[model samples]
Target chain A: MINIGVDLGGTTIKMALINEEGKMIDKWVIATNTIDNGKHIASEISKSILKKIRQFGLETSSVHGVGVGAPGFINLDTGFIYQAVNIGWKDYPFKAELEQLLGLPVIVDNDANMAALGEMWLGAGQGTRNLICVTLGTGVGAGIICDGKILHGVSGMAGEIGHITVIPRDGAACNCGKTGCLETVSSATGIRRMALDALDYIDSESILRTMFETKGDITAEDVFDCAERQDPLSSTVTEKAAYYLGYALGALAVTVNPEKIVIGGGVSHAGDALVKPLKKYFRHFSLPKIADSCSIDLAKLGNDAGVFGAAWLCMQK
Target chain B: MINIGVDLGGTTIKMALINEEGKMIDKWVIATNTIDNGKHIASEISKSILKKIRQFGLETSSVHGVGVGAPGFINLDTGFIYQAVNIGWKDYPFKAELEQLLGLPVIVDNDANMAALGEMWLGAGQGTRNLICVTLGTGVGAGIICDGKILHGVSGMAGEIGHITVIPRDGAACNCGKTGCLETVSSATGIRRMALDALDYIDSESILRTMFETKGDITAEDVFDCAERQDPLSSTVTEKAAYYLGYALGALAVTVNPEKIVIGGGVSHAGDALVKPLKKYFRHFSLPKIADSCSIDLAKLGNDAGVFGAAWLCMQK
Candidate 1:
């Protein structure tokens, strides 16, 4: 049987039809509108799925169910988007609306959680019962699987590793209104911000200065590139960010002690450049046994993780 | 039938005989000689258990099994003490030794993990599947329960909350050679140390100085008393410690999203003096829905949690 998978994001909605084997038989992407008129957006999502099904010459009856992965807090029981800041959604009955439009069974969960489920089923953590997936995008997103089950906690808000207090007393302010969250040091935007902050303190004899002048904006990529080119200031900034990110990961390891931690997202593109430093400092900060047993690896499946995981969720029930 | 429970600590070994109803039918305590041979300590524990059983009028055949709780890292699968610094134990086959002397099945686990299990089965978390137990004494210890099962990650070190870094950088040195560990800011020793450190910068008066002079040592109790009396310095120290601790709990809630958090240990005795501030800061730092559903309550089992949980462990399998 096939399942319909939807990857709901702030700017776009990606829909796919996946078979029991998790292969995407058909797919399409549509621009997402976050306006209060969610009915229009709901219709758009339905149309996207139906169009893909028709194009692939697949019968509607062949689909088993629909699974959605939304970016932000979701009530798994109610399928409610409790709050998604990026999409300006709050207490929205997402599943009800989508089901109303499509006339199908639907399960909705946190995006990172869905991605984690995907990894556990088909990606880096294929057979692992205890694993963690961390996505280092604009903001850090995490999914924790324990004993082969996703932990939704009491409010379905577990795996918010981004907000764990890396700097307790005083550090940079977070969008969560807290200071020194793990994301403030680990995310792509966080890395770029670190470079800009470092530019103020250190002499800017950096390749980043030249790149930024020409590119109009600096990215985490620019920072990593400059650091690799032996730019002292950029290396220091990247090292500092990696050090703290590792420290946060170390803290996370001590708390959950997952068997495998799969690091994903744009910044993970640096591969060993990011993970090497993370592993080094992670050991320094983590308990010896936990550090020794847990393996930190780059995430497989990339952006496809969301769609794959959503489909996997449908297959579960 | 009855079972024997032994809580092996660095300085004391507490043993109890528990009946089928989970009641302590008899109990005894003996000093532990850490510097002595391991077999001798095991013999003392066996002797203590026998004495407790004899006093309770229970025959050897009436005992189901033996359960022991030991501090520090433990291998649940092997029933070995991986490393226990204060107890001077490393890779010690304690359960095997105890079983040899007593001629009975023996089960062992980390002291805090078993304590939380004890609370989950018979105390504060009796009916809950997701609970976190934090013991705040000389050091902080945590035990996590998810979906009716204890979360003992791949290596049986899943709940090391004290070692997780609360502060990103430039915090106090932990005995484990790490900086900004939660134990450095939240333990009774941490709170008292904060009070002394704050005295160098602040000119606020405190009765704790005279109290400690006469008592020969200061403790979290003394700090709480001064805070209750509205001493500014003590209040600052306690509030700061509570805030950081609460912040970490808030961060932890986002990650674990537990149904309830049971606070135990000596410093927890400060009651509302600590909890009130902790709740305030926890809410400030946690995601809204998570902060609303999860609660911080005092551990009901007290020092007996270890014994009760140890007994319950044998009853389980």
Candidate 2:
């Protein structure tokens, strides 16, 4: 069956046609025009999807359904998006609007959750029923899958791993109106902030300081790159970030005891430099038994994970 | 339908016969004979159950099945107890042995998980599909119920909340071979230890000192009683313990986001003295969104939670 997956993001909308075996048959990317509070998003997506279907010479009857991953709090039962900040959509009837235009079944889930499901289907999760997929990008986010189902707590707010308290006292302020969140120390943004903070220290001779002087700022990538090159200052900053992230994951390990933890998004590109220390601290904090049963791996699907996960959502319905 | 729930512990074997609505129709308690490596436990339970069934004038058909809660690292699918240190059992086929002796189907699960399920069915959980029930006794234990099913991650160690590290550095040693675990500061054993440690401080005037001198050692109950009577030392210990427990729950709120958190066991008897401070700290540490959606309540089932939870296990099958 042909399933259409849509990864609706702020800057771009990624769409793909996936087969029954979860292989991508066709794909498309279009600039997201969030004009008018994203009022036209549904119509634009449907139009683009329909045109692509015709060009591919696939009959309408062959199409299974559409699955979408969008940012924000959602009513899973009703497919309603509540305050998706990046897309500027609030309380929009996303599922109904998309279904009305497409004339097919549709499923909507959080973008992070979609990524986790995608990884579970054919990525780092390797078909594990219990998994935690964390995206450490500009900010940190996580999707929890238990017993092969996305766990959406009371208000669709479960798996907000980034906001878990790590510092407890005198923590960096977060956009989520909290301090000491994992996002404030482990996200790419947090990593960059820590690097900048560390560079400001007296006589800290490092390439990161030179990078800051040249580029006016250092990125999470710059910090990881310097650490890989054995820059002392950069290594300290990366280890600190990994420490908190690892500790948080350890706490989560005891709570849910996932079979696998898939690390994704930008900061994950740091590769072994990130995973090594993260794994060490993760082992240090978690029970030996739990740590032994669980494996940590880099997310393999990359950007396409969202779309793949979105498509995987269709199978659940 | 009728189900027999068995709560197998080190000192006692609490059993209950319950109707379809989860109400205990009859109950009995017997000594847990740990002699002979507890090899005769299954037969002991089966014979007691048969005698009770006959006394109640019930036919074999009326007893749908038997569900048992045993301490140990269990294989849920096989119902095998890997090692129950207190029960002196190792690699015992609990379900098979019980089924053979009783001539009825048997389901076995971790004792802690059963308590959580029992609370979910008829206690503090109040029928919430997603809930966390923690038992703060000699050591801390937790049972996680997600979407109305017990969550046993990988190897039946999903809800090991007691092991989550709270101190992270230079904390107290734990029986789990960890340093500074939540159990080190939050269990009944932990509370007594802290109260004793605090009483050792110079120039401290408290009834606890008088009690400890006379009674040889203070119980967890003495700490709460003293704290209730406005003893400064005891109040500090209770609040400190509550702080760690609350912080752990805050982190868990972001992971599974249970609708309700049920605090039970010996420490829960402290009532408002324990919960009031725990709720304040829980709210302080958790994201406002998650903290608002979740409520903390005392476990209503008390000692009977195990039997009720064990019975709930039968219904799941």
Number of the top TM-score candidate? 2
Model 2: lDDT of residue B78: 89
Pairs that clash in candidate 2: none
Q: lDDT (0-100) at residue A135 of candidate 2?
A: 96
Worst 10 residues of 2 chain A by lDDT: A199-208
Q: Which DockQ values do the candidates obtain, in the order shown?
A: 0.63, 0.80
Candidate 2 structure lDDT: 0.91
Candidate lDDT scores, in order, read 0.84, 0.91
Off by over 4 Å in 2: none
Report the TM-score of candidate 1, chain A only.
Answer: 0.95
TM-score of each: 0.86, 0.99
Residue A314's lDDT within candidate 1 is 89
* Residue-level lDDT tens digits of model 1 in A183-232: 88778888888888777677656788778778878889888888788888
What is residue A228's positional error in candidate 2, in angstroms?
A: 0.7
